[model samples]
Target: MADDRPPSGLRSLLRDDLRGESPYGAPQLAVRAALNTNENSYPVPPEVVADMLAELGETLPGLNRYPDREFTDLRSALAAYLSRGGEPIDPVQVWAGNGSNEVLLHLLQAFGGPGRRAIGFTPSYSMHAIIATTTGTAWTHGRRSTEPGRLFTLAAADVAEQLGALDPHLVFICSPNNPTGTAVGLDVIEAAYEAAPRAVVVVDEAYAEFARPGTPNALTLLAGRERLVVTRTLSKAFALAGGRLGYLAADPELVDLLRLVRMPYHLSAPSQAVARAALRHTDMMLSTVGVVKAQRDRLVAELTALGFAPVPSDANFVLFGGLADAARTWQALLDAGVLVRDVGIPHYLRVTAGTPEETTAFLDALAALGPEHHLGTEKAS
Candidate 1:
């Protein structure tokens, strides 16, 4: 049998910090309804695909040379696209990476390291802690109330208290936080900045475009706060997950610092070309957002009606509770040709908002399962 131990029995050679760590991923399973990862289920609009292909085709001839190290034009397009959020941003203030995870890795690479620390509310983005660990930064599990009713939400006072006491060097707050879909308030972010005066505070807005009306984003607060960062992705709302474009908006000086840590010509020419093309058709790419949100809302109402407690979501997925066993329920759903995420939450499972028909597939699968799978979320709580 192949041993799972570090290759060549090199346990002693492996970094002590990385011991016992498992790489993060979701099941890439085939099913009739795949509502596991919160990916934008819609295909890119045909016209945008043509545009991407045309733009990328031009870049193909230049593969012999390194891509523009600065990625000037793509940055301009990203800034212009971000500005639609009611906040005008200069191209100098933006930087990108293969994915938001890499963008985060760059942040920790620059601002975090041995002898420093980072804090994030537990069950936020798992990668926040993962990146901190790999960078030799101490990961603090900033906790919120576990009491019933409040339900996975963070408060501003809690932010101020934990950050002030810990005095970490880097912090992350995810709006429309993953797994739970709870959107953090701006007041909490401001509190985090105030509490960690010397730290770089990141607001991860991967699902910002999916937020319902009146759910404000952190972009408006970037004006005077030099230490603040707002990270976004094309993977979710823009329906460009395969294109692998994630970016951040921050002070130009901070954007410059990332250059010190990043590899030369980090973005490939084709990557930049495709992203720029998609950015040119921002409205069309994001046209999927409304439909996804409608399905998201439908997931909330339907899950609740099915006796599971569904968290209010501003993102493209719903985390529903009241399972007798999340693992069993996940397997049962998979057996029934539907796949959902068992996010390690005891009684909860999260499902993505797919096309309306796919939504029906998931719901219908769940309805077919016996009630023994769990209790009502209200009753469970």
Candidate 2:
């Protein structure tokens, strides 16, 4: 009899964008100080977890069925949290997904695709490019006019010039940007948004909780800006990284469009319960933020004193230059059981702030490496 089994041709017909992609693993299991990923060192509070479990037990009837497709209750609670400090927001204008990464993918799907172009600042978060490429959208990089080690301070004029020329379909700006942790001024953000009349501007405030008081929030600018969207994550300051809840606050029209493409039952019932309970205890999360900020400051000072040229940061992590070979330094730190992110930007590395004990261990490891690894005098690239 002839072989009736299907051929392996399905693999060949898969999307070209996903061909060689592999999972990005964390050094969590191996490293003593797990700082490679920007996760909170603090665990979720016990009371909050208990409360969520209690709620889940009570909601067992719904567990057998699909979760609320709209996630309406979670959206309202998030809106209330965002508006708690005098900044009002409408629940109708918010949308969420498994994580901010998903939220961003939906935005790109809604606004950018094959014929559309996505523009982002270089050395920003790497995910923007990944998402653009996977969506088959042309992705372009605009160099920030700041110094080599200063990736966070982009020139609004330079960005405007690019916007005038390319007129990209989507633009992404990460405030208190990942890796660098520096914030772009709101005026610069406004300038970029104004210049891109035909494009949608995405302001990613994943680390907004770490920004200083009085810093402009994208929500504060959303009143008249229909082309702007602000994406946030509870994973950061809310200590719910494992919960994987993220949201976008935008014009109701845009929010509605995102909802159209979002997969039904995107948020899990347990995840929703956990996030809502965490939000109810927002003050506890803020207390942890205070501790992280203080530790961040102390780490910056120590790194600078050690001649590492640490970049000024307003987030839970710090980036610095002066390593001889960042990859090798990363390896050495790993050998010493300390884990950090190597940006592969010649001599730059990023270290996320952890608990006091973990931070002490990392500082001791760097201190042992000493001034020889300081900028410009180390091994050749």
Candidate 3:
């Protein structure tokens, strides 16, 4: 549903689809257990913070000069970082932007435009549609397998059927999909690329670090596929959301073409410096991944025990159904100083896996709910 929330005077000047659509954001409320936006709840380690400050200090002297328009060193660092995925990603095969969203926007700007189409499955990232439409590329919302036993699984057959029907210019596969928290199989991605021979297929792996063991990332499929892209971010696992660094791995030729859509010196000096510094201490920056994952698993188990059905998540959040009233539960949690995401699902709400203390707070608040909140749950200690 398009949000008809924008003003009247700007309607004539704005793109028809965007005129009334609100900018995307989760609630930014202050709470005791703030698990709403899927951001890593951990602060950057003090040691990493000091090193980042040192890196920024060195860049202050060079601020007069524009950042490396090519982001040479940062690209090398990101390439090296991604190489840990076992695919040996070369710097030439990497392209970056302010964040993964900008990387998506760059992809849309380069390949998707007026008269072109971009397609992504529903219950996935909303940005895929927003960016496509805003870039003047028509957006086609795809569906997951409707068969029983499949909640949000995107099978290869689904990819084949959808691609055959739409033939879009861009195809987005968000593994460890948002809201639902389920990862897509590498087979599904392969099917998308093979089926959409004429389209650019993007796999958004912003939460790849939190995926369960044996969950294969699409980075392994990049070789020889010029149209396949795998985008990663330092925001979630790396605790670098403030650093605003996100990059993608693709064929060198594709990376070169993306450079065309980017403005001169788009990555600022300090932004590049901080990102490089954080990348250098990737281990320290990502120290909280295990803790977050534990809390995520705890959420799934406890929610199930509480009579709510929680989706198994490969990402650092849980989406639980069985809420008698999702909106009321959201408000009650807020009143109890806990915050979560409503995600537009009627009986479901998404909560980020936070610190152990935060997890306890959320569970305690939830278990306190009575029949007014849901019938499936028992309110007990």
TM-score per prediction, in order, is 0.96, 0.93, 0.95
TM-score attained by model 2: 0.93
Candidate 2, which segments miss by more than 4 Å at Cα? 1-14, 17-25, 148-151, 370-372, 379-381
Best by lDDT: 1
Candidate 2, overall lDDT?
0.85
Candidate 3 residues 66-107, lDDT tens each? 888999999999999988878899999988888899999999
Q: Write the per-residue lDDT of candidate 1 for residues 166-263, one digit (tens) a residue.
A: 99999999998997898988999999999999999999999999898999899999999999999999999998889899999999999999999998
Write candidate 2's Cα lDDT for 1-381 as tens digits. 997554367756778676657654455566689887888889887887788888888777679888888888899999998897577899998998888999999999889989999998877888888888888889998777565754558777877898889989999998987778878888878889989998899999999999877777778888899999999999989878888999989999999888667787888888888887888888886679988888888889999888787888889999988787788788888878899998757788999889999899999998888445666765442
Residue 231 error for model 2, in Å? Answer: 0.6
* TM-score, predicted candidate 3 vs. hidden true structure: 0.95
Task: Please list the residue runs of candidate 1 whose C-alpha ends up more than 4 Å from where it truly belongs after superposition.
Answer: 1-8, 376-381
Q: What TM-score quantifies how close candidate 1 is to the native fold?
A: 0.96
Prediction 1 global C-alpha lDDT: 0.92
Clashing residue pairs in candidate 1 are none
